[model samples]
Target: MFRQLSERFGRPVAMAILTLLGMWLMVMVTLPQLQMIDYSFRPNLLPAQLGGPEDVWTLSNYVTLFNNEIHRAIFFKTLWSSVLVTLLTLVVSYPLAYYLAKVATPRQAALCILLLIIPFWINEILRTYSWFIILAFRGPLNEILLALGLIDRPIRFLSGDGGVMVGMVYAYILFMVFPLYNAIESLDDNQIRAARDLGAGNVRTHWRIVIPHAKPGIATGCIMTFMLAAGSYAVPALLGSPGSRWFTQIIYNWFFEGGNWNQGAAYAFLLLVLCIGFMSLVMKFFKVGLGDIAK
Candidate 1:
């Protein structure tokens, strides 16, 4: 009877079962995060005293968020840094993806793609630490520059915004590349040939034929890279100095070191909500849904 019902449902029953299972898994994993969310809304002061019950509910956490300019600045700074990193990734990955898709032979394309994957095989912390060595004051880059007479002293790259951006771009390039590659691979090469055959110039052919087709992947890559970059705590904390700290670093500090989970949760939820809003805005502007990109 179950088999017959599943067959009659035409895969939907299977999907529904899987969906429910997935939701259950997600809820289980997220229970602690949900507790944190609940914790964020509680009033920290004037609670558990003066006959107040534990977990006193209040909106002051969020209200304090709105009232605090420093927190707002951190949020916007993180947003901007993520945006910049995503844009840089897209710019760097696009031509590489285009070449791999349109020009490179199968063997060569496979090799290039392999190079991108090679970095991930190493521990991510190892990769970030490797950059620290390269970018540090007494590192090889500085030595070489000194040899070349570029400067009298070592340059400061490991503890600045420049180092943070570099680390972010390196870490997130694969996210940008694979999506663009997929989009470009799915494009009908015949249409491009047709455009060329009709005397359409390269610029015209690309703008009229390729750009619209690849829009979904562009959107996907940007959204993915931006979200990951913005939420990353390790890269920023490792590479950046106090003045250049990313907002995730701030949230992590508040949560772990400061022992103020309420503020931390507030910060985290704001970041989450902002990311959702960014993706929604992108989808609306591009007229493409996440499902469209999945194909």
Candidate 2:
């Protein structure tokens, strides 16, 4: 890889780039992760207990997570819900990506891309709060439904998992779309034409030709969407009711509300592990390597 980079960009440039990347990984990623791992292995101590005999290293934080049934359930629930959100985003974005990549004219595609990006110009917190307002009991949706006589009363949309899922899908849909678009745009039009000429239907052409080409992008999109959804704290906190507990919320409580940084670090480390495992599984399933995604 380094040889290829050097040949492409010259040896000095490649060395400089590699040095910066190495520094970034060491300072920004590795050091923090190591610190978190250290924190996770130690017991929580009060300010007065600092440097005392009680401030000993232990695995009690991880043990607490395993022993607590509620935490275990919430952790798994967060993992699966994030997966569902990633799938939902892919389903909803693929057609739009196809349209942008293969169907729409250049001008129309540019317009559509702008429209998609406009929403992100706003603050994410504001966007999530907008969903909260839209899903509230007396919000615009309920008002319209009541006027249309679809229902006699307002539906409580914000008090369940449905609202969180909706917000998640909407928020991360762009991540899925852009990757798929990049992948699909690189496909040769002639291949598609040939497939159609050979009496292949739309479904078969896409399944046999287009989808195989888009696997790397799909994997990339899924990884990004799943990681964002799983680690997200704001959307779930704002949209989810108390009954719908997200794992990040649990981590937040452990760190801030419960004043237990050790437990929080343990939860954070576990989440990191789960995300790595998920990404590995996705790469294996799609038969795509990291090099393919980098392309």
Candidate 3:
């Protein structure tokens, strides 16, 4: 990799790039992870007694997570909710991606992309708050339904996880769309044309040709969407009702409210494990290798 980079750029520039990447891996990723793992193993202690005998390593934190029924339920709920969001996002994104990559002209695609990006230019917190406003019982959506005589009264959209789901899908669908677009854009037009000429229908063409070629993108997009939704704090905190508390909220409480950093680290470590396990499952189901997605 270094040799290829050095050839493309200069040796000095390549070395500089390599150095920056190394620093990022160590400082931003590896060190923090090591610290979290270290914290997870030790007992939660008073600040002054952190290095005292009472702070000895133990499995109590991990064991507590499994033994606590409420936390365990929250963890599973977060996992299932993230999976649902990922699947829903993929369903919505694949057609839009196909339209932009294969159906629309370059100018049209650019315009569509610009429209999509314009909303994201706003801060994510502001965007989530926008959903919170839109999903209130007397909000525009309910008013519209009432005006159309579709309903006699306002639906309580914010009474459950529905608002949070809407926010998560809205926030993360872009992640799915772009990957699918890039993969589909790289496909040869001739293959699609040839398939049609041989009497293949749209479903058959996508099932046999397009989908197989786009497996890596599907895997990457699903992984990204699921992880983002599962690890999400802001959207859920804003849109979720009391009944829809996410696992991350529990982790936050453990760290800040409970003043138990060890337990928080353990919970966080479990969430990380859940995400990695989900990623592996997606890759296997798609028959995509890590190298394929990297490409």
Candidate 4:
């Protein structure tokens, strides 16, 4: 690997890049996680109380999460909602990605990709706020539905998880699409043609060849989409109703509003762990190995 990198970038440059990567891993990733884990176990102390007898490590922060009924419910709701969002993104993106990767001409695919990326030129917060406006009670969407006689009255889209889910799917759908596209794009077209010529229907061809070959992309897209949806703060904050507060909001409240860093860190750490466990279950169900997903 070092030799290849040196041949490509020269030895000094390759060594410098490797050194930077090592520093990034230690400083940006490992150290912050260690700090958060440390804080999660310690007491939430005032400046004066810190390092005193009452500042000793304890499990009370985590205990609070397990004991609080409302928080427990919110956490579970957020978890399942994120899963639902991931599934919805997969369904929406797979066909589009397949078309881009397999069916669309190069020019057509480039145009479509450009269109998809154009929306991202705007800031994400502004995009989410736009969705918030569109989903309002008398907003354009509800008004359109009413005009089309789909419903007699304006629907309160923001009253529950409806608005949040919509925003989440819209926000994170591209994360699923790009990964699937990358994976499918690398596949050999000959295999697909041969399958079709051998009396295979579209469904069978895809089930046996396309999907299995795209498993890595599916795994990568799902993991990234799920994690982004779960960790998202701005979309839910702007688009969700009070009744549909996300778990991240609770973490924010603990950290800023409640002034309890210990509890906040505990909640944040629990969220990370739960997401990993949930993704593990998903991987097992799909028979996808961690190595494949990582690669």
Runs of candidate 3 exceeding 4 Å displacement:
1-20
State the C-alpha lDDT per candidate.
Answer: 0.85, 0.94, 0.93, 0.92
For 100-128, candidate 1 gives per-residue lDDT tens digits of 99989999999999988998999888899
Query: Alpha carbon lDDT of residue 219, candidate 3?
Result: 90
lDDT of 4 by residue, 142-256 (tens): 9999999999999899988888888888888789999899989989999899999999999999999999899889988998989998999998899989999899999999999
Q: Predictions ranked by lDDT, top down? A: 2, 3, 4, 1
lDDT of 3: 0.93
**Residues 1-57, candidate 3, lDDT per residue (tens digit)?**
899999999899999999999999999999999999999999888889977879788
Model 3: which residue pairs collide? none
Worst 10-residue lDDT window, candidate 1: 43-52
Choose 2 or 3, whichever is better by lDDT.
2
Listed in order, each prediction's TM-score against the native is 0.87, 0.91, 0.94, 0.92
Alpha carbon lDDT at 179, candidate 1: 89
TM-score of decoy 1: 0.87
Give the lowest summed-lDDT range of ten residues in model 3: 50-59
**Candidate 1, superposed: residue stretches over 4 Å from native:** 1-5, 8-23, 45-54, 148-153
Number of colliding residue pairs in each model: 0, 0, 0, 0
Predicted structure with the largest lDDT when compared to the true one: 2
Clashing pairs in 4: none
